[model samples]
Target: MPERSLAAPKPALIEKVLMRCAGQCAVCRAWSHQTICESCLGLYARPLPRCWTCAARLPPAFVGRPRPQCGRCLQTAPPLDRAVAALDYRFPWDGLLQHFKYHQALDLRESLLERLNTALSAAEVEAPDWLLPVPLSIERLRERGYNQSHELAKALARRRGLRCKPEMLLRVRHNDRQAGLKLEDRAANVRGVFAVEPLLAARLRGTSVALLDDVMTSGSTLFELAGVLLQAGVMSVQAWVIARTPEPGDE
Candidate 1:
């Protein structure tokens, strides 16, 4: 008898299994078929006006502008041409992201990715030529066992039918985590830390690209990464974050 070849499980089947295994909503703890119950999502992730370049929540006064943007972004533009955030990094999402990013609870990925997909659709975000996840340094990758942003980017690429380039950008230097750093110091921590992969640099020229990340806090990392891509000659860079950290006193 010949040995049989093994086939991989379907993505839909895998997602279904993960959803069922969640058993309850991560936010409200309500028993639900999905990882996050719809009610909790509705209450917490309500769409809000945000800066087109930075994804910062826009004040009511700024609403209805032809192109909405916060004062900071207007005075000095960010490296991103456009930005879209699925939710705010507050309360339930902040805690949930900690678990998803630090605890190896990858089952949350399906729910998270779906939220981002929905936001992008609602925002009418154009599909870029390539989707690039901010790269993690070799040492960090060894410790974390995975790059959460890469996971999110790959899923988004599959859903949107764009090329996913996980290694196109390299974290040439490993720096301290941005969480503990002061807002003023965060930019310094990430400056000159990212570079485009030399062999792929030529291909990126004059192409539109999107940077996918699990969260954007202070925009330091994304800004630095975007600047590098722009310097590498990409025509445009968009920031797509699952969550954005609101500034102090921001609703």
Candidate 2:
């Protein structure tokens, strides 16, 4: 009898199934096995038109004015020359951000970075001379064992071929969390909390810098840090945040 040929081995059924649904999407509960499914992202994660100065959401009909600024920013300018956010700090993003910052899910860093990268591209933001993380206070750094903003800045800088300056901003003291604070009081909490690193100070002179942060609740923290950068003679300051808190009920 002719030698029988062996059939090619088949992949395990369970393996196929696992590969089919790697993880469920957090927002829509779809079996995309990704951080978020395309449908959910298409529906909820679409970027909003933002105010040029503060990065707050603006209406689609809005057109940037003589300077491409919103009413609030036009009335009282932000320290940032420009600012933008990836998401509206709502639903799935709020949860994802909490995971990135407060929880130990370090894997979320890559997902968040990917989202931020996509946003930067979609917004067509300009590259800056320096990319910097909003620094954590020493106590917070020791407790967390990682600075989310610094990690983000480094990764983003690589994508844009910019220099990541993690040491550019120093948070001198830990302030109460801004999560629940009223807008008026938030500024007071973060005021005088940031100072530029003296040795690295000279590098910022006459150079445009972009600040990276996980979230922007109020403008206080970024503003405070930008003030110091401006004092050090930074030509311009811009901010890129993963999420921006929407007005109450705007969620």
TM-scores, one per candidate = 0.94, 0.86
Question: Which number leads on TM-score?
Answer: 1
Expressed as tens digits, the lDDT of each residue in 1-251 for candidate 1 is 99999899986578768787647888888988888899998898788788999999988777666669888898998999999999999988898888988887777898889888988998898889999998999998898889999988887888889999887899998899999899999999999999999998999999999999999988999999999999999999999999999978896
**Where does model 1 exceed 4 Å of error?**
1-12, 20-22
Worst 10 residues of 1 by lDDT: 58-67
Candidate 1: C-alpha lDDT: 0.90
Clashes of 1: 0
In model 2, state the lDDT of residue 33: 68
lDDT for each candidate structure: 0.90, 0.81
Clashing pairs in 2: 23-33
lDDT of 2 by residue, 138-237 (tens): 7888888888898778777877899986877888888997877888999899988899888888878999999999999778989988988898899899
Please count the clashing residue pairs in each candidate, in the order shown.
0, 1
